[model samples]
Target: MKIVIISPLWERTPPRKYGGTERIVYALTEGLVKEGHDVTLFATGDSVTSAKLMSVYPRSLYTDGVSWSNAYWPSINISKAIEYSRKIKADIIHSHSQYYGYVFSPLSPIPMLHTHHGTLKSQSIGKEKQATLDYFKKANYISISRSQREPMPYLNWVGNVYNGIDVDSFYFNARKGQYLLWMGRFTPKKGSKEAIIIANKTKRKLILAGKIEKNNRNDYNFYKKEIKPLIDNKNICYVGEVSQGKKVQLYKNALCLLNTIKWDEPFGLIPMEANACGTPVISFAEGALNETIKNGHNGFLIKPNNLNGMIKSLKDIDKIDRLTCRKWVEDKFSVSRMVTDYIKVYQKFVKK
Candidate 1:
């Protein structure tokens, strides 16, 4: 089947540093191509993919230091994708862009599937809420997790497909190294501050690695007031946004990954990545972490915002077998499995 994947303009496919959505899109595109399907990736010019790549922008908006007000790019990108789909008589157009798919789905003659990568509560606010209600029925939506769909149960959802990763790329280390890990955006919702608290409480060496874009004042302020003060370099080390190689090393070596997210994260890739590395994750029971972390099996899932729970889980982290963590991802979150599941979704809408 011929498939076109629409990626966000902010980052390249399989972003060098920090981009969850783009990474998932890259994995999905590669997986489909590996399975002998003809795939075309609609992304930034710099995006690297095995499939044919179509782009409107020279590079990622953020990477090129482009201003955020240049919002016309998304429309242009979507238009290009729509035109390409019609020209090629594509079997399906799978969109990872949050809003564009819904906006243009009705205009397209071919079947379109959109993977909802974010929380509905955040997206469905004022005018966006009305727009969603208006155009939701025209598009087929796929949730990243069952928990993500709870906020908008009324939407026309096809199914839930969990985000997946390339397990082979992530090397597994059965023998874990010293120090804990906290990797994500340096934001309040991500609970970087809480990770510091947990690290201090448990007296474990914690390595914090993630991006803090220059435009995000709130993240900068949060880093200064909440995270920076506590960094001792020995206990809590702040390693700014890491490359894929560094990320693999961190995950493979860390004792466990701390996912102290305070918000309803749509779907976290870090936890699954950690699992792929034979590393366990200690996450709060919020959003998709509930499904991602298997208590006492691969990792422990504590109650949200419960510091004591985090402290206690750390004590029992040794009980989690490293091989179990690796096996869990192999069984459930491999890229091959994700591709097979998505192919089933595509076959449902493809013309026989």
Candidate 2:
């Protein structure tokens, strides 16, 4: 099948610092390519992928010093992507962004699918551009989690396919445990404060790994004032922006992964990643946490923002079978599974 993937212009297909959507896009593209599918990726020029690459933005919009022009001109680039898809005779166009591809999705000659990666919270819920949502309904809609699909009732609920990763790349070491690892953006919604409280409660050495967006200064201030003071005594470490190598090491050597997300998380990739590395995740029961973390199976999911519960839950997390954790990922959350599901979706539409 000739598949064309439309990625968000903000970052590379596999982002440098903080990009969940980009990582998923890159993983899916690579998985599809490995499965003998003809894949064409439409993303920023900086995005590196095994598939044929087409650039819409000159540089990644999420770059450190990028200007507003990088954000504004992406639509123009997307228009070109649509034209390119038609010329190349793409059999299907799968978009990861919500609004950017709506203009082209309706008029495209081939079947299209849009996967919503982020949660549709209260703020962005009712206020979503009506015309854009209308345009989205023209094509099949893939929700990353059922929690994400709650707000958009009008969209065609084709399936809820979770994002996946390369389990082998995670590098699980069965006999390593030093510090508790918190992996995610240092945003309030992600629950860094809650993680800190849990760390303090448990009296465990904690390592906070992720980037703090410069634009959200208030969130940065909260991190500085609230989360920083707890960093002393060698009990907590704040290591900003970890690489793939460091991420694997962090997960492999951790006592457990901390994910205390407050919002309706679309899908917590870190939990599965931790599980793959033989480290269990102790996260709040929200969004995909209820779906992915099986209470006491691969990881433990406690009450929402219950710091004490999360801290207490850590003791039982060890009981989860590490090999079973790896097998669970292989059975459910592997990139191969995601690619197979997407191929089924593509074939469904193309056959009709």
For model 1 the local lDDT of residue 330 reads: 91
Error of 1 at 318 (Å): 0.5
Q: Roughly what TM-score does model 2 have, to 2 decimal places?
A: 0.93
List the candidates' TM-scores in order.
0.96, 0.93
| Candidate 1 per-residue lDDT over residues 98-168, each given as its tens digit | 67668888888888899989877744345655466456655799999999988778888987899888899
lDDT of each: 0.88, 0.80
Runs of candidate 2 exceeding 4 Å displacement = 64-71, 124-126, 129-131, 134-136
Residues 81-152, model 2: lDDT tens digits: 678778888888888866666666777777778888767665644554555676567567888877777776
Model 1 TM-score relative to the real fold: 0.96
The best candidate in terms of TM-score:
1
Output the worst ten-in-a-row residue range by lDDT, candidate 2.
64-73
Model 1 pairs whose backbones collide: none
